[model samples]
Structure formats: structure tokens, C-alpha cells
Target: MSEGVVARLRQRLRHQADLGEVLAGGWTGLGPSELAVRPVYLEGSGTVPLGELFDLRGEPAGRIRFEGDLARADRLAAGLAEGEVIVEGSVGAQAGLGMAGGTLRIQGSAGPLAGAAGPAARRGMTGGELIIRGSAGAETGARMRRGLLAIGGQAEAYAGHAMIAGTILIFGDAGPDVGLWSKRGSVVALGAIEIPATYRYACTYRPAHLGLTLTRLRARYGLPVKKRHFAGRYHRYSGDLADLGKGEILEWTAE
Candidate 1:
């Protein structure tokens, strides 16, 4: 695979950036000026240009990779309608906000709202796969309408708040208030989790979906996949009593 222009530059924003507008320029064909142009934010103004910050290579080939640590990068993939975005290290808040399609993979931890909807938006992650190899901050999948969010590590509170439909898998212990006000969604907790009071305990059973989901997480992303996690029994609790009450929390149980 050929490298893109970002592989050749270091963006130290003279101002803030609107990644949405920056990436809008079709990645297929571009010159140095077009590729070097990225939006950044100033004190009170909007974003600035990429050339002012980073050094600016190839072109947008529908796939991009951030090689260095981007702990300060915010909205790394906001409103991304297509393509594959890879973050080599940790990311700031709203890492994949309002993504409609494509794949976002983070090798390290992600700040709050990793796959959450944008502010005032009605939905989040309408369609896509967000793989966080490390832990995720609070509201990791807030207001998710659809898509798959897999956290190989732990997740903070309010993980699936107000989810309409989707699947969230947490390999580590989930914090308090994990899923609240969800209409219809599945929260698969392979580790310890205390189901919300609104959720009523359903019969213990084995879900077939985990097998397919976990397999991809392991083979595609290099996440640890144990035999137990695949064939494990889960205690299903369904609710959101205050809402439509169609969502569920599946806590992996010892058979």
C-alpha cells in the first residue's frame, strides 16, 4: 500500500482544526497545496490550514494511518462517511463522532465519546466498526444508533447511554450505569458488571453473536481471544424501564 501525505508532515496547529472540512477534499487525486490544506482553530476563530502546522506525500487513497502518538488529536475521524482510519496511539475526546461508515481502529486508549454522536445530533456511529484496543473514557458509545463498538480493555461509565440499536462488547469490567435509556441494543460484558436496576434478569444462555464478533476482534485486530469468552454463558438482563425497555445487558457467566 502506498503512503499518504500525512505520512510526510507534522501538524502543530497554529489554530484549531475542523477535520470534517479538511478530509472532505477527495483523497483520490491531490497536489501538495491541496493535501497540505487542513483546517485549524484559533483562539476564538475557526480552524486554520495544515501547511501552517505540519510538513506536508502521496494522496488520500481511501485509507489513512496515523503513525505517531496522537493523544492531542481531537475528532480524529468526525463525520467520516467512508474509508479506513487507523490511529497508532491514544486519541483525544470524540475520536469517531458521527461516523456514518467505514472502520476506525485505535491501538491505544481513547478519550470520552469514542464512537458517540456529535453534540445535538440524534445518532452516533450510524454504521461502522470502532475497535479500541485499549480502555475507553466515559460515554464511549453514547447515543449510538447502529454499528459495532468493541473495547478490548475497560470502559468508563455511561457506555451505551440512550442507544437506539447496536452492539457494545466490553472485555473488561464496565463502570457504573453502563447502559441506560436504551431502546434496543446489546451490551456484552465479558468481565464483571452490575446490571442496571431497570433491567430485569432473563434466562441465562449462550449468545452465538459473540463467536463471530470476537473472532474478528482477535484475528483482525490482534485482541486476545480466549475459548471461554467465545463459549461462555451469559446472564441476560433486559430493560430501560423508563424508556422503551428493549435493550439488554449480557454479563458473561461461569458455566
Candidate 2:
């Protein structure tokens, strides 16, 4: 494998920029010079070459790193079907919209709809891993079909709204209306959360899958997982009785 590509911010962004197209599968094979010319939609400015905003370096190797404050950058890794993407700082909305494969790791917080479906799309994050080491905004995994979404900090309301099938793990406080209209998905909350009224209480049990999943998060992602988490019991709630009623919310409880 070749050394991966690196794109460092050249200057402070005055406007929100859309970087969705910069890291698609085809662009991963291009050299730095060629990749630099990729289009980035800048607010008010219309469009500009990525090279004008970032200093591109390194070689293509199916991995890419973005270094700098990108809090105003949206869609940093949308539709990523392959390769790995690492963002060293915060990002704007739609960080992993419609991603089908690969991994998108964000070192800081993300805006609303971080791993949700696009405006025109029917599904969100069919496959892939979205790891947010910080808090996330509202509707973090809305309409998701399949994949793993891990949030290390607080999540706003409707964190898993309308989820079809997938897994969402929130390590901090989850906001209101979690798992509102989920069909068949799992929302695991390690912190305080209010179960939606549409869900019904299920028996408490130590799910075998929870232990394995927490182990992976600790070993691979370095998430803070204590022994209590692995051995704790979870309160399972089945809902959204308004929809398929197969979705569940797993709230961690001290045994």
C-alpha cells in the first residue's frame, strides 16, 4: 500500500464549504496535484478548487487525512464507499451522509444530521463505520439502513429518528425523542436518556452482543469502556410501536 494523502487547511474559511466530492472512490487514486483541483462549493463564492483552500500533500493509498479546524466544512466524507477518512477537528452538517462503506472518524463534534440520509436519498449510511469522538447535533443517524455509528459525547434530540436497520451507540447523554420512528435498529445509550413513549419496556438482560461490541470499541477506537459497562445490565425497550415495532433502545443500568 502507498502512503495516504493529507490535506491541511491553508487559511481560515470565511464561509461554509462543501467537501462532499473531494474524497469519493475515484479521487483516491489521483496524485496530489490532480486531487488539488477538485471542486469545493464555497458559500457565496460559488465554487473553488480544493487546492485553493487546502495544501495537499502525500500520495494516494486508500486513506486520507484532513488536518485543521473544519467546523464550517460540510459533507467532509459523504458517500464514501471505500478507504478511510480521518478528520482532526470538528465538522459541519452531514459528515457521513449516505456513506456505503469504509470508515469516517471525526476527532471532534459534528453538526446536525452527521450520519443521515441526503435530502433526496432514501437511505442513510448503508454500510461503514462513523466514529464521532465528540458530541453530535440533532438527528445524528436519521433514516439509516445499516452500519455502526458511535458517538462519544452528548447527542441532541431525535438521534436515531426513522432508522431502518443499524446500530447506534452513544456514550454520553442522549437528547429527547431517541429512536422515534425506528423500524428495526438498536440504540445503545451508555448515559442518561428518556425512553420514547412509543416504546414498551422489555426485560433486563446482559446481551452477549453488548460485551463484544464494547470490547471492540475499547480495543480498536480507544473509547473509555470500564468493567461496569461490559458487566452491566441494560433496559431494553421495544418500539416505535408506531412503525414496525422491531426497533429497540438499550439503556445501560448499574447492576
Model 2 agreement with the true structure over 147-243: per-residue lDDT tens digits: 9999999999999899999999999999999999999999999999999999999889998998988889889888888898988899999999999
RMSD of 2: 1.2
The digit string of per-residue lDDT tens for model 1 on 182-243 reads: 88888999888878898999889988887888888888888877889877788999978779
Which candidate ranks first by lDDT, i.e. highest?
2
Number of the top candidate by TM-score? Answer: 2
The lDDT per prediction is 0.78, 0.91
Q: Give me the runs in candidate 2 sitting further than 4 Å from their true place.
A: 1-3
Shift of residue 200 alpha carbon in model 1, Å: 0.9
